[model samples]
Target: MQFKNRPNECVTTTDGREVWLSRSVATAVCILLECEGRPYILVNQRGPGMPDFAGYWNLPCGYLDYDETTAEAAMREVWEECGVNTLELLAQATCEFFSAPWDVNSTPRGARQNVTIHHGLFARVAQLPPVSNANNEPDETTDIRWLPLSDVETLTFAFNHHERIADFLAHVEKLAGISYR
Candidate 1:
């Protein structure tokens, strides 16, 4: 089929078909110890000047690099954004595929079409790490915090990350044979 370039995001086939390319992203849901008897999860706020969702909270996530496994990328993002180096990945929580009509003027870079793989990890720490001092990508993340699960519903999240957090919580609940609802 004859190929036509579409600004590196899509290809036009000979038969007038457009095929979109997707980027694989890895997201980590890091569960930490109970604080004041409430379970908390790690999250980061997007830095100012971010291409999309600036100032919004989200799980530690990023596009997977070449030759890197999703789990490896997830762990790396956790360290870069949350400054947490110790984690035991429990499982692959979920995978989500998202796509929309590509608009060159409005679509954020690296989000034309994305396949996000979420991994659930547990961190054994008595206190939260000093993110500002240890974060490797300060430009990508402005703040890192351990958000109590009870407060998730009150915060705004980017890229539907709230759903990912919910899924992880459900998985943990299943494992513990307890239901929050």
Candidate 2:
């Protein structure tokens, strides 16, 4: 099926360029697991070929496939990327994020004027199977690991992912009624 443009979705900039306006909902699942008897969040660094922020480490994230719900997308991304299949939805953040093409005029394949809506969800699990580089999806990532939240602050993340992860962590803490930091 062809993607229809939303009403007033495409807006021409002052530079006189026509671009497509596409909006997609994505899920970023924060999965916690015990490694070496300590709690760690599953994080990943996209391979060097990704169009976005390549090789940047962040949480498990992906766009919602057609006919998939938010929760299902979350679980699927976690499982496909990190080999974690079992997860319980803990909390969904209050705010979602929109990432639109900053340079619509120059972006290739008319992907420039698109806006992406990102949903952040927290997931808990007993443990994770070993992260494998088994799937090939564009720049399929390989350097997957479990790390403390503090590590997130020090590492470089794709887009505003670190902030989003921080937001989810805070939301989880609020839901638990205690500060885990």
Top TM-score hit: 1
lDDT score for residue 84 of model 2? 56
Kindly list the per-residue Cα lDDT of model 1 for residues 1-181, writing each as its tens digit. 9764345478789999998664434444444444444567788889875788998998877877878776677767777777766343232222111111111122344435555566654333445555552655547877778777788888899977787777665655665544443
The pairs that clash in candidate 1 are none
Q: Which stretches of candidate 1 lie over 4 Å from their true place?
A: 1-22, 88-111, 123-125, 178-181
lDDT of each: 0.61, 0.59
Q: Which candidate is the best by lDDT?
A: 1
Q: What value of lDDT does candidate 1 attain over all alpha carbons? A: 0.61
